[model samples]
Target: MKHLLRKTTAWIAGAVMAGGLMLPALAEADTIKIALAETPSDELAAFFVALERAKANGLDYEWTAFSDEELAIQAVLSGQMDIGFGTPYAAMQRSRAPIRIIFQLSKLKFFPVTTTKYEELEDLDGEPILLHSRGGGTDSIANVIEERLGIEFGERSYVPGSSNRVAALLGGQADATIIDLSNTNKLMRSPEADRFNVLEMFEVEASDEALFANLDWIQNNEEDVQIFVDALLSTYRDMHEDPTIIRRETNPDGPIGQLPEQILGELDGFYGDAVDAGLYSKDGGGRVAANADLEWYSAAGQLEGDPSDLNIEDFWYLAPLDNAMN
Candidate 1:
């Protein structure tokens, strides 16, 4: 299947060489190779729907799930993939790869969760916290919180997943941290949920996950790129207008379709909540998101320059999305 949700591999060449495992052959020259940062889930139902629409329009593609977002960015930078998923603001600034984001898949829709000891962000001024990684999205959220709220944290620890981190909280390991929408929902609904609080977060419009590609490749594959963006814009708009469309359009034979009924049952609710929360923008975040990304990423310590001084065109190619909207 082109949408191989679980298509993980030995991440590096050295790992493959050492393990002597047979890696799948690379995609054909004309095929669009997509690097997924994580396994497909209900959150990606709309994205897979867009891919299906693009395929019907003659888009040829295959996807591989990388172990993490950074690996996906590296794959695209190494020319092993044509398109990738990540908010690669740091990579775009630090590397000369000409990588430009084409679509903002989702925004920084995270929430601050803490025990009753903390009622708001200000309450954790000098408290220790847990996050996904040191330089990842959640870590950047913490950084931005400190910058915007004028408070400094005590210690930052890494725990990788929200389920695990919430357990850490249960075990009295940490009191406060940032978590995604789904995990926050799960935590707040648990038996011991009364002990936790979902802090009121300021509106964040910055991109958390986006579709990016090398400028050269994007220029060379303009037609396919337009098709892909057109499909994505259509899907995003439709989902926002009527979030249930995601579940309706999900392919029964695709990877997302193969998910267990328990998980699949949550598609409509998940996307509806996402739409209600404004996790996605109708125009795939052409200029507004790019600008917000500059401010947010700069505050998060991912991008070095002042938000106002950095050029949006340097990080985002808004033409495809603009064209799609028009």
Candidate 2:
């Protein structure tokens, strides 16, 4: 009887030990939450690719859809999100929270979409315009327009998404708006296509969406951060080589795939549209480093010193991207 009791107790003790060992794994398995503005534009394709690679690296992730990039950055700054996507310039210079852009996502290639009344940037001097968000990518482009053409938009309105801004224009709620390739393509296919004209705009010195995290949070989660960055570098290489890889690897049941059926079916169309719009590159070697230098010059006012005098090293740490790329 004593021997049998001893054996049973030993089995229970072993089971408890095994369960204890799994506790940390279960805790570590908690989803790493990220946030980004709505719309799966080509600029953000690398992230979807990273998510797929992240799973294989034992990192689980969930994403939150924000109305705009500024809000997404706010989420990360507030600690409500583990990571979020946005241009590194504003967050680095404007935000109160300490955050860093660990990965370079892409560059902005925005064109001005205006009514027939406005043929050029000069025509917009006294006109109202809609943008994706205030103090965001579109706003930055607007600033560039004012600088280049010496014309300032009369009234600036903040509409959150490219689709939302496009709809507002189509519905006659706004006269003109800036938009991305995805919505730009959709607008051309709509009945109001003839109502607006896309103006030829120069490339602005702005980096597109990038992965950002609260500095402290990132330091504590170093391993996970390395894993995420590695996946991003790998995915970026593949996306540059063949943009179609994203569509093929998209989880039909996952968020990227769970996009409205229409959008899903038109994935290739969007990719092609973006490429035609000069929003993406086929070379896959995105101008990550050079663009950062240009961005510094453009955002000179935001920095304390002249861009020519400022050290790029103070703002960017390419070690992460370099490590991942290697």
lDDT of 2 at 263: 68
* Whole-structure CA lDDT of model 1: 0.84
Whole-model lDDT, model 2 = 0.65
lDDT of 2 by residue, 1-326 (tens): 00000111111111123433421111222457788766564445557777778778877667778878878877776566777877656456566545666765655766688777778778888789998776677887787678778788889999877777887887789878888767776787788888888888776534555677766566666777778888777765675566677788887766566667776677667766655555543222234543554454365333444566655544554556656655
lDDT of 1 by residue, 55-76 (tens): 8887878898875688889899
Q: Each model's TM-score, in the order given? A: 0.87, 0.81
**CA lDDT of each prediction against the hidden true structure:** 0.84, 0.65
Error of 2 at 49 (Å): 3.0
